[model samples]
Target: MYTFVLPESSRLQEVSAEVSLEELQSQPLQEMIDQMFAIARGERGDTEKRVMVGLAAPQVGIQKRIIFVDTGVDIDRKNLGHLEVFINPILLKKSSAVVLGREGCFSVDPCLCGIVPRSEIVVVQALDRNGKSHTREFSGMTARIFQHEIDHLEGIRFPDRVGPDGVLHWVKEDEYPEYRKNWQQWKVLCSWSDWCAMKSGKSSV
Candidate 1:
């Protein structure tokens, strides 16, 4: 079984390879998908309390272009809370309007989060688990989640998308409420590059 790859691990920095149809139909790949779903749902023993909204293959020590996302809403704006798998996903388009929102990653320290600017809407093309091709347009939180996971396939983490003026904030799991109430007052951490260097043992914060 594969384990979650941390930011410090070099595997997280490598671009993931595409999954061929033959490999996709293999038992091991199917089992990995099952494991990913379990981890996303916080069903795994090592999973944290916060269920992951999305995850990529590289995040779990697999260098393949696979991602699972929880599209929290349905077409009618109803809460669906279901997971979908995308293999060899590609971003087809992105809206000109950008929105800044707080984001955290499972591969990184859960307490570390920062504001990330993302397109308000995105068009993505990929194959489903069964090898069916899909080209869907996603918006709002769903779009954000899709973009984040796709970035992972390209070896890009959420912190790498943080703007120059943006700073990552470390909030303790127990003090989330207080942090939310006074987020601006929280201690500012280093930039994404600095964090990467520190994690790689190239430098300190």
Candidate 2:
């Protein structure tokens, strides 16, 4: 399965503790980021899904303070790009413009999930694959995914921060799968986009 992006909490088992960019020896963070993009673009696991625009270490079973993203780019059933990143990220700041957004997790169970609250913008610091540090200032969906994956590295899940409007009862969560099983038959699917859609009950892809 498409490199199963959703990792369980304990998947944080033995992470790369080298917070500084220089400490990681494994393919370098930028190379790792490129690998993540490869996984997203269907180069690594072109099994069922044909594209991947984002990925974390745990998605491929690595535990490091890195994720790859193309903040303003979109990859769906149409145009996909190599426009992505190897983010050695730390969320140093955030905006107070709280917005409710639909979200899903590569680590969360059953795959499908709901909307959550997140900062509208963020600034982060991390290194590229070469161990040369780069920082980015991002807003909207890009900021949201950065924070979401960062949380994963620290053993957190999206449902823990869900919005009140999207709260689920056990009964509702159960019902959702059956309804969507039939509904999903006609919808175009993309991990990066559909995860966004899980929150809104519509795909952003």
Q: lDDT (CA) for every model shown? A: 0.78, 0.56
Highest lDDT: give the candidate number: 1
The regions of model 2 sitting more than 4 angstroms off are: 1-9, 12-16, 25-34, 43-51, 74-83, 163-205
Candidate 2 lDDT by residue in tens digits, 1-205:
2266433334643344444645554555545565666665654243233234456666676666667665654412233434455545787789889876555544554435555689988988877656677677888767777877777666566765653434422213345444334432323232443334443345322
TM-score of each: 0.85, 0.63
**Residue 154 of model 1: what lDDT?**
86
Residue 175 error for model 2, in Å?
Answer: 13
